[model samples]
Target: MSALSLYALFTGRKPPSVKYKYYRKYFIIYAASMSSFAVHTVFICFFYVINIPILSVINVFSVSVWALALRENYYGRHSNAIFLACAEISIHAVLATAYLGWSSGFQFYLWPAACLATINPRLGVRLSSAIGFGCIVLFILLKTVVDDGLYNFDFRKYADFFYVFNGIIAGISLIFGICSIRVINERQEEKLTDLATKDELTNLFNRRYINSYLSEYEPDADLENRPYCIVLGDLDYFKKVNDTLGHYAGDDVLIDVSRYLKQRFRSSDVVCRWGGEEFLFLLKDTSLRQAHDLVEKICRDIPDNIHVCSSQRIRITMSFGIAASTGVSQHEQLIKVADENLYQAKKQGRNCVVSSEITG
Candidate 1:
């Protein structure tokens, strides 16, 4: 299970993600796993009159507390692995020490640890390997010195089988899990990259993302291969609404406009919040004329009515500018030209589209 799960992580899926809707399910898993720990601890207590190995039972309790804390309201990309690792720790602490059955509770030990290793292969390998080795050491020492009949030949026959099982599980998980870390890290890095480039409010790729995306767009072809046009847009009279109503109203307007652009454009295009009341778009494989038409459509379709503090309806408009970069110069040049044209649109009518003439 450990080996298969780790390998599946490499190509099967993009790791587990924590979403708000699944909050209840996460709690359920945590409860079940913690209950497993409690049950294991309880079962072990029956052997020595509820007094057999209280130390491990206590550790299980502590680990359960840690599990609850880690799995609480704190949801992230890697929280599942962390929770599973904690669960494994609790299970093993009880099984290895309390049950003293290396073959029983520890049977599925590799599964949870494997989950950790799968989610973060590199860190999982390094971390779980050390943990695995520690378990082995503890297993050998405790079995030989304490449980081996205090220097007598007792349960000695179980040593080889237990050691072999632990060795194989630990060795395989560490080896393969480490190998897949680079890939997992790459995916995580992509998500972080998306966050940095996307606007939190509207979820449109930001100017920064558009800039970097173009900068690293081509490896062999210089700036000449991008074939992208830029459109700069500014919300006209946006400040008046904020001053007249409130910033909340202005924010709602901005959200509405952003949604308009996102739904109106093609999937290949990127829309960005350039700044306060200003936005930019990267229209892939498009020309200046096409960009102009697109912006014109948005200008004509934008709703003018926005509700106010006293339930009064208000109207709004936007101005846009267009410029094309034929993958020949810096991407910023197109944006600058677009900005100039956007200003021209505002100057012309405050609710129109203007295309900037290419220079040089």
Candidate 2:
């Protein structure tokens, strides 16, 4: 399947269109909980083999806590799950450090917990940072106050191995938490970009985005000898539709027309919702004649293809005007020319295409 389909499958969200945000907290919590469960299960086995019944039983409780946290996360109780996870980690770290000493690396898990707290959206940044700082203070206290160990076990020989293993696991958890924060930031940036550049109702590029594109667009002089064309289209009697049929029906008509226009244009072309009931097209490497023909066909097809909105068949016509890039250095000049032609088309009569050549 496509990458978008795979993303939807994993995140349980459809592909983003206009304004869309996906909550990744559930995935992060679920993964963290499951990993914690597996790690504690391994610890339970290790402690049992090494004859530490207390630590083994503590690990059993850790596993149960993680399992419950996972279930809570699955049920959409994210704050509860996060609280459970943080509490379990804090308690388990202190207990493990007390039993096996700070050298065993159990206290390292507190670092990731702190990082997680700072990134959680539910907790304000100030409070989360304070919680993270508290974890750090707790870590320092445990290191200074805790004695070598409580139980004088015969597992001193395996101290280095346990230390290395727990250290690696803790490091991985920390890295995962950092990556989660990065992903959340990137997704937020994407949402902001979409909000700024896309039309909400039609999910088409907005006037601002089109203007930016025109400003930034630099033509490759060597490969692109042909001039591009700009076509401005306006829906005929659009105000009447909004006034008579209501704004809701007008929105449906705009959405349907936008979809149709997007499908009719080539992939290289830029289709934008210029403003209310108006669209702008940037046809790369297209002549005025070609643009006019394409737009004329669309104009004819719109009326024949009735748009059904709220059980009402709405037949709408569009007028288009085309202007080709002919020694026009400024993008605004080209758009102005296109707009003049569009006005001429409307004056002559609606549902027709007008071009610079025809007007000249």
Clash-forming residue pairs, model 1: 223-327, 224-327, 304-315
lDDT of 2 by residue, 1-360 (tens): 477744543453533321223347777776788778888999899888889988899999999999788766655677778878887987898898878787777888888778767766678989999988988998898889885767646667877877898788889888887888788889889989999999999999999999989876624521355577888999998988888799998899899899999999998899999999999998987777788788889889988774655455556999988888764346677788889999999999888988884221
Clashes of 2: 0
lDDT of 2 at 322: 85
Query: What are the TM-scores, per candidate, against the unseen true structure?
Result: 0.62, 0.74
> Pairing residues by index, what is the TM-score of model 1?
0.62
Give the poorly placed runs of model 2, Cα more than 4 Å off.
1-23, 34-84, 121-152, 157-161, 218-226, 243-245, 309-314, 357-360
Would you list the C-alpha lDDT of every candidate in the order shown? 0.61, 0.81
C-alpha RMSD in Å of predicted model 1 compared with the true structure: 9.7
Error of 1 at 318 (Å): 0.7
